[model samples]
Target: MSKLENIRIEGIFIKEEGRKATLKFDMPFYADSQPVKWADSGYNSISLEIDIFDIHYLEIKT
Candidate 1:
């Protein structure tokens, strides 16, 4: 499994029928420490979507 750090969330979508949720991110990178710079030439331009199904519970703390 790949570990992604400091994920910047771009969008969120939810499906009420299936109790599913999707998280969208742009150019996510795996780093041991520190956040990656967006302007870095080494970074790849990629889009990521994570889906969660049958979520039993969720809490949002801001």
Candidate 2:
């Protein structure tokens, strides 16, 4: 796997409400300007509520 593929996001699915869902992760998050790149800066464990509409697609791995 490439470096990007090796970047795993370990999180618990909180819930889905309307067109939004929340995730609670223990991993640090970085605000990347590019869609496929991790930025240099990052924040500690965080919970994020993201709009489903903003997502172009979803990928789930079993």
Candidate 3:
């Protein structure tokens, strides 16, 4: 399986009080792949890791 891309969030809560928050993540990719950058040939699915108290939702493009 391919490694999932990582997204860094600035803070857990931004004026909101809760254990969860919404996030925006870029599609997983490898920089070494030229086709993925130029031809755009990357996989659509990716594994994600989140903080212990945080939740995540990902929307991938087909």
Candidate 4:
């Protein structure tokens, strides 16, 4: 088995009204970005809400 700390964000899901609705993406966030709210300590996936404008700017982490 792998260690808890070895686990990392592998995907992200965002739900927003009047927009794309449900979006599931494989990601790590970004090298220069900050970590957002996670679903667990050994977080490998996340669910959040995002605006239409910001959707194009999203990037995966290192």
- Best by TM-score, which number? 1
Q: Compared with the true structure, what per-residue lDDT tens digits does model 3 show for residues 1-62?
A: 96644643333332234455544444455345444554564555433334434434433353
State the lDDT of candidate 4 residue by residue for 22-62, as single tens digits: 43343344324335553334465433433343354455465
What TM-score would each prediction reach against the true structure? 0.55, 0.26, 0.23, 0.19
Stronger candidate by lDDT (1 vs 3): 1
lDDT of 2 by residue, 1-62 (tens): 52333334455352343334444333244444433322333433334433344444456675
Q: Which consecutive 10 residues in model 2 have the weakest lDDT in total?
A: 37-46
Model 2 scores what on Cα lDDT? 0.41
Query: Model 4 clash tally?
Result: 3
Residue 19 alpha-carbon offset, candidate 3, angstroms: 3.1
**Which parts of model 2 have CA positions greater than 4 angstroms off?**
1-18, 28-57
Task: Supply the TM-score for candidate 3.
Answer: 0.23
lDDT of 3 at 28: 52
Q: Where does candidate 4 clash, by residue pair?
A: 28-61, 29-61, 30-61
Clashes of each: 0, 0, 0, 3
lDDT of 1 by residue, 1-62 (tens): 97767667798887887488988987555444534574465654567898999988776543
- The order by descending lDDT is 1, 3, 4, 2
